[model samples]
Target: MAKKKRFLKMKIATLIMIAVMLVITGCSQSSGTSVKDGSNESKSSSGTLKIGFILSQTGTFAPLSEGIINGFKLYLEKHDGMLGGKKVEIKVEDDEANPQVALRKYRQLIHSEKVDILVGPISSSVVYALRDEVEKDKIVLIDANAAGDDLSWSKKSDYVYRISFSNWQNGSSAAKYLANNVGKTAVVLAPDYPAGKEVLRAFKDAFEAAGGKVVKELYPKLNTNDFAPYLQQASAENPDLIYAFFTGSDGIRFVTQYKEFGLKGQIPLAGTLEFGDELITQPAGEAAEGIITGINYSPYLDNELNKQFVQAYEEKYGKLPNIFSVQGYDSAAIIDKAVTEAGSANSEDLIKVLKGISFDSPRGPITIDPATNNPIQNFYIAKNKLKDGGIVPEVIETVENVTMPETSPFE
Candidate 1:
C-alpha cells in the first residue's frame, strides 16, 4: 500500500508535467498565443501556473489535510495535470495547524515561492489569521475544508472561493435532519472558536425555529481532550439527544469517551459532519456507530462521477474517499474549470469565471455563489454504520443546492 501510494503520487506529478508540456507544444504550433499574458504580471512570468497549498501536514489535522492533498493529486492525475493548456505546479507548506505558523508560511509561499494560486488550511483559525495576507496578495484562495461561516459574507473577499459547505450549512443541515428524523430536543456542544461558535449558533437557531428545543449549549475551549465534564453536564440536562461539532483529536476522544460514559447508544448522538468523518469514526471504534451527522459528500453517494472517484481513490490509496478528500478534489475541479473558462490564470479573470462556474462534482452538481464565493451543492445526512467490519458513513438524506446567506454576521 505504501509503495502504491508513492507510485500514484509520483505518477500524478509526472503525468501532469508531461500533459502540460504537450499542451504547451500544441499551443506553440497552432496558436500564436503566448502563455505569458500581461494578466499575470504579479504572478510568475513562466508559462507554468503555480499553486500554493497551505494546510496542516503535521499535528492533529494532518490526516484531514492528507485527504485534501490526495484528492487534489487524483484530480490532476485524471486530467494528466494540465489546466487550461498550462503546466500546473504545486508547492505545499505545512502550517502545523497553527495560525501564526500558517501566516508565516502563507507569506513565504506568496513571496519566495511565488505561487500564483493558494489552497488551504483546514483550521478556521489558521484561515482567519491568513485572511489579511490572502487579500493583500490577491491570489485565488480555494477553501478546501474549513467551514468558517464568516468566510461567506462577513469576511468574504473576492480572492476567496470555497467548494465545501459553510458552518451554517454544516450545523443547520444537521439540525434539520435531527429534528425531522430523530428527536427535536437536544444539547449542542462545540469548541469555543470561530468555526465552532458559528456552527453551534446556526444549529441552535435552526433547531429552535424548526420547532425543536435546545436544552443546553456548551462551548469548550479549542483542543480540549477531556469531554467528561461536558458530557456530565449533558447527562444532567438529559436532553433527548446530543448535537455537537468536533474535529481532529478532540473528535476521536469525545466519541470514545461518550461511549465509555454509557451515553452513546442511550442518548442518540447527532452532530455536524466532522464527527461522522471516516478518520474520526474508525479511531472512535464502535463508539461512533449510529451517530447521525450531516455532510456535503459521502463515499456511499451513488453517481457516475462519485463511482469513478471512489474506484480511482480506492485503487490508488486503498481507502474510501471522505468529505476531506472530496473537498480537495472539488477544489481542483474548480481550478480546472476557472482556468479553462477564464482563458487565463489571472486572478481577476479567474474570479469572474469562478463566480458563475457550475459543474458536476463527486458530491453532485455544484455552483459557486458569486456574491459570497461559497458553493451551492447538496447537503447530506450520514449515519455512521458498521459495514464490512469497519465503520463507514452512509448517506441517508440529501438537500440539493443548499447555499449561504448573502451577508454572514459572523465574519
Candidate 2:
C-alpha cells in the first residue's frame, strides 16, 4: 500500500507540472504586436496606455484603413509616441468591413487585450455592430470614420464620441447651396445601404426645405458591376441635376460611367465629399471634373494648421491627405486633449472630458456637441477643378457651425 501511494503521488505531480508548462507556452505565443512596427511588445508597463483599433484593413475599405492608421501614427511620431504624457501601445485588428467580424474583433480587444480605449471602423455597419457592445462594456470609443446619422440620435451613447462628420452633415451641407445656385429640380442617387439611405433622406429633407424638389431617387446595390441601369433611369427622369453619394470603387465606376453616358455636362453632377476627394477624383480623372460636393476637409484649405498638416503628411506618406486621414489625425488629437484634461485614462474620466471638447483640427475648428456627441464644424461647398493635371476641391462657399439637432428627427 505504501509503494502504491508513492507512485500515485509522483504521477499527479508530473501531470501538474505539464499543465503549468502548457499554460506558460500558450501565453508566450499569444503576445500582442505593435501597430507602428510589427514587433511583439505586448506586456503592459506602468504609465502605458493600450489602444485597440478595429478597422477594415482588407477588402474595399483598405485604403481608408491605411489613411487612418498613417494619420494616427504621424500624430504619435510628432508627440514622442505618447498621449497625455503616457506611453502608448496599439493593437489593430482587421474586420474586412463586416459587422460580425468587427464584433468578434471588438470582443478580443476588450476581453483578451484589455485595451484602455478603442478607435476605428470605416464602415457604418461596423460602427452599429460595436455600439451596443461598447456601451455594455463601458469602454470609450472614438468614432473615426463611420457616419451613420442615428449614431448622433436615437442610438447615441455616453461611451461613444464621434471625431468624424456624420451622414446628416454630409447630406445637408450642400443642400441649400445647390438648391439656390445649381438647380431647383434634382435626382438623388447613392448606394443601397444604411448610410446611403440616411444621407439621401437628410438631403431630400433639407433640399425640399430650401425650395428644391427631388424628382427622382435611385439606390444602386453596393459594388454593382455596371451603373448603366441607374444612369438610364436618371436620364429618363431628366432632372436639372443628379446628386450622388458613392465611395471606393463604386465612386470611380459611377463617375466614369456618368461621363460615358454623356450626362456629365447635360445634367450637373453634385455629391457628398467623396466625389471631390482624391480617393475617387484621382482615378476618375477628367471624369470627376466639374463635380460639385459638400466637403468638410480639403488638402487645399488655406489654414495654418492644415498647411502644416499637409506638409508633414505629404513628407511622411508622399500623398495629399484626404478627409479620412484628417479624421484619423483628429481622433488622436481628441484623445490626447481629453486624456490631458481628464488626468486619467479611465473611461469615466475620458467620457467627461470628451463631451463638448473643442480643438483646432487639420479640417478646421471642431467642437463636440454635448447633446449628441457629434462634431459641430464647418462645411464647404466645393467644385472639383483640374489644376496642374490634378483634381482638387476649390472652395466656393463656406457653411459655418453646422450642428445636429438636439433630438433625432427619426424620434
Candidate 3:
C-alpha cells in the first residue's frame, strides 16, 4: 500500500512539472510572436506613409528647390523621421524644371508610385499643368514654392493648398511700400506670362490707388539672361524706382548688371519675388545690398521657431534659408498637423482637418483659405544688406496679411 501511494505521488509530481514547462515555453513563444508582430506593424505603417517630392533639381529652380528639399529633410530629421508616430519616407523626383516632364513625373508619383502626399514642383507653370491630375486623384498637394495667384484662385481645388503667399499679395505689399514711402514714378519689369501680367497689374492697381504713377512696364521672356538692353531702357526712363520681377539665374543677372550699369542708389529698386536667398543675397554679392524687395520670408525674422530653423539649415547647407525653404518647412508642418488632427492619412480626413487650419510657420502664422485652398499669410518688405561677409536680406517692415479677393477674375 505504501509503495502504491508513493508511485501515485511521483506520477502527480511529474505531471505538474510537465505542465509548468509547457506554460513557460508557451509564454516564451507568445512574447517572441508579439515582438515580431510589433516590428512588422511598424514596417507596414512606415510603408503606408510615403511622401513624394517633385522639384526642379537640375534646372532654373534648382537653387530654390534644393533649399526646399533641405528644409523638408531637416524637419524630418529633427522630428526623428516620424510624424505623429508614423515613420516618414520621402521619394524625390527631378522635374528638370520643364512643365511637360513635371506632368509625367506627377502622374507617375500619383498613379504608379502611389505616394500618400505630394509636396512640390517649383515652377508655377509646371504646377498649373498638373493641377487637374492632382484634383482627380484626390491627393493633397502642398505647394512649397510656387506662388502664382491662379493656383489658389482659377485652378483652385479642395486637394490643393499653398504654403507660400500669392504673387498678388507680394505685389500689393510692394506697391503699397513704394507708393507710401518711396517716390511715385516706377518702371515694372517681369517675365512675359500670366504670372508677370498678374504681378504687374496687382502692383499697378495698388500703386495707382495710392496716388502713385507707373512710368513704364516691360515684359521680357522667361529665360532671358541678358537684361542690359531692358535695363538701359528702364534707366533711360529715369523712374524713381524699378519694380523688377525676373527669377532664377535671370534675377542674378538682372541685379548684377543693374549694378554694373551704375543703376544702384541712383534709382531705388523694388519688386516681388526677385530677391530670394539663392539669387539676390549670395550670388549677386555686394550688388544686392540696399535693394528693397517684397517677400513672404526673410532669414532675420524675429521668431524663435524661425531662428532655430535658420540655424539648423545653415549648419546643414552652409547657406541662409530662402523663401522656398520657409514655405517647404511650413508645408511639412501643415501636413503633420493635419495628419495628427485627423488621426488618419485618408484624403477626406486630411482635407477636413486642413481647411481653414492655421499654424505657426517660419513666416509667422499661416492660415488656409477654405474656398480656394490658398494660404493667407503676411508679406514682408525686405532690403538686402551685407552681414557676416555675405549678403543677408533683412525685413525692415512687416506687411499686414492680405486676403485674396472673394471673387478673383481668374476664378
State which candidate has the highest TM-score.
Answer: 2
lDDT of 2 by residue, 45-159 (tens): 3578889999999866788888889899989999999998889999999999899999999989887887878998889998999999988878889999999888888899999
- Models 1 onward score TM values of 0.87, 0.89, 0.86
Candidate of highest lDDT: 2
The 10-residue segment with the lowest total lDDT in model 1: 31-40
Q: Which stretches of candidate 2 lie over 4 Å from their true place?
A: 1-45
Best-first order by TM-score: 2, 1, 3
> Model 3 scores what on Cα lDDT?
0.78
Which parts of model 3 are misplaced by more than 4 Å? 1-47, 276-278, 409-411
* Candidate 2 to truth, TM: 0.89
> Candidate 2 overall Cα lDDT vs. reference?
0.89
Task: Provide the RMSD of all predictions against the true structure, rounded to 1 decimal.
Answer: 12.2, 5.6, 8.8
lDDT (Cα atoms) of all candidates against the true structure: 0.83, 0.89, 0.78
Ranking by lDDT: 2, 1, 3
Give one digit per residue, the lDDT tens place, for model 1 in 224-248. Answer: 8788999999989878899989887
> What TM-score number comes out for model 1?
0.87
